[model samples]
Target: MSVISEEHVRGGSVFKDISADDDDWQPTEIESLCMNCYKNGTTRLLLTKIPFFKEIILSSFSCANCGWTNTEIQSAGRIQEQGVCYTLKVKTKEDLNREVVKADSATTRIPELDFEIPAFTQKGSLSTIEGLLDRAVAGLEQDQVVRRATHPEVAVKIEEFIQKLRKLKEVENEFTLVIEDPSGNSFVENPVAPQKDEALTVAFFKRTVQQDIQLGIKADDDLDEEPAGNDLETMRNEVLTFNTNCPECNAPASTNMKLVQIPHFKEVIIMATNCDSCGHRTNEVKSGGATEALGTKITLHITDPSDMTRDLLKSETCAVIIPELEFELGMAALGGKFTTLEGLLKDIKDLTVSKNPFICGDSSTADRIQKLREFGEKIDKIIVGELDVHVILDDPAGNSYLQNVYAPEPDPEMTVEKYARSFQQNEELGLNDMKTENYEEKNNVPAVPGGTE
Candidate 1:
């Protein structure tokens, strides 16, 4: 495709009657004069929509007479008003699995690696975060700038940089992934978290006049607008709300329902209710999306203090069981909580302390309370790497996840296993009563189950 010089024409014009067929295959072909051979050739054009990005036009021309061929890609949508920057912290192996969309006009940088990949050198791609780093390493390996280095010291430094890029694929290494797209067509899927979670950061900034000119983008482009706030509002409005009778006071209570998206897990509907008459509040969590047929168990040994900093997303269907402490917490014991390992432990300790008053009145019970306090002290020691303890998450719905910071590299302290749900678990989840053989007939299969699947 030839580049359009006129900003207005490039941003405002639309292809005529271009549509995808049943299989989503729509190609427009035309006979055109070849620029190289001066002979008739066929130019085929295909327009496709990129997820999280705008539509792109892929064009190919080939002449049968002189054997001339050319291929190019261009944006079929309007220019963006503001650029986008995505920052992802690669703390563990799990973060590498995050999906990323990089437009051809986007520039990728790894400050820790002291490397930068300029725009337009490679075509746009949808890939995992690790795959992106692999591409960068491959590009640098083949770059003439590194091969033509005159100084031996400079060449050694270049080799070291490439080695660091390779090391990032390992779980032991931590780095930051940054991508900046002037076209505003690139994105890195954020792992679901609360508003304050720093795992992912997205920013939008106005491009300078010179920056736009350099990218062949127009200053007056009106097609691009920040949609993050609008998207959140739209999702909030889609939540289901209704009224329910309070069990205690038999008064009509309003229920606020919201669908929460959990990264690497199925969606859940959170229903919270408050009885104004009795001053009672209750919250219930229901799995909204598809349920996994199999169950998952994640086990991690707290070996270091830094392990407490790792993030955890626990689903309401999951059960946290500490075999070392002979303590088991079921789904009813705790609702879904997004927190670090230390935060989870502290919450459990606080809950135990809340029951201390009842035990204080009896000598036997008072001794048990003292033992509970000692257990809490042990947990604190585990958090500080003074002691080692195992934490297990067992979820029949397969909705729970433990952060894996040192991925690719084997962490002997951690293990994740998937197994068929037991009869009791299936019955508890109401899965035993449902027939899976009819799923294909019903055309309703839940999305892929998380946790090793």
Candidate 2:
């Protein structure tokens, strides 16, 4: 991936008046830089709740050097001052209207803030509260206790305890507390104790208020009603059964058979169907053989554009093009030589003056190739001071034969059998397989033993 540059910030303002970007909207480098500048070091801005297009940015910046923290609330937009300063309530209609216009429509709704603990409030022991609540609920069965709590007076006490738990959940520091009754008697046996402030165990406490308890009370008040019976599976099955039909023949389709899904294409295929009367076996989906949705088997041809020897053979020379020339070079890492200069030259000369060539060689192969190119009196490959030559072989009908070959690797992670198969399919062509009445004499090859059958 490329590094993000500064241009992103300049264009971000265009989107400022628009709705807030998605949370997953990965910021460009310049946009990140703009956000950093907006922070101004003193306060951090957390993107929390947003109203429509406006984002609720929570800024809390802490200085490590001085152990100081500063927090600010900003309406997320283009980070402009006017867009961020509309939190104060307006006193008059005109003021409200003016403030409304300044408020960012894209601002996300802020989540409800929980109760805050007052700094001057008497400190309470978290462990003490937990122990007290645990002791209070210990003897009672959770289901039965919650059922009893449905009474007005009991519910009020539980709600009060719940509120205390909520406040306890908000405390950030660890501290111990000692409680004393109004009679001046200490509550705890030991005065001093070690404790860590923890989030109020509200979920555990909520379980104390059980569903059975609520259900019993709901029953007592004649408010309980039987839940609707669920037959979702049967309904879904009926819906699926309704849709199960062949478009072409209106036959019942089998759900047991799995269908092949080709990408970017639509058509439910039913394979191997037999028509009783017509005795015709057919596939359900149309044979969209060359559809764009169906992946194509691409054939590539890599060639030097400058080669003209093949064109000369087709136009003027009597020699017919022998398109297939097979030259098998053993695998590289087996300490086997890929190609020899004489072998390469012999293969090129043996061609019917029309086939393109595949030239593979060592780093200093140009000198060797130039000598081979001289033997045929043909302009074959451009010696670009490279060891390899990948040429496109094509018939006069523009049927390309040769595809691409990657640069030779020290240890190509392919089996020799696979390499051999690829060679037979892609690179090699049979040039000697061609026939002419007097071609044998011109090429100086011996006559066949069985004569011209």
Pick the lDDT winner: 1
- Models 1 onward score TM values of 0.38, 0.13
lDDT value, residue 289 of candidate 1: 60
The per-model lDDT (C-alpha) reads: 0.70, 0.28
Candidate 1 per-residue C-alpha lDDT over 395-427 given as tens digits, one digit per residue, 9 for 90 to 100: 888877777877666668889899998897776
Worst 10 residues of 1 by lDDT: 355-364
Candidate that would win on TM-score? 1
**lDDT score at residue 430, model 2, on the 0-100 scale:** 22
Deviation (Å) of 308 in candidate 2:
73
Error of 1 at 154 (Å): 4.3
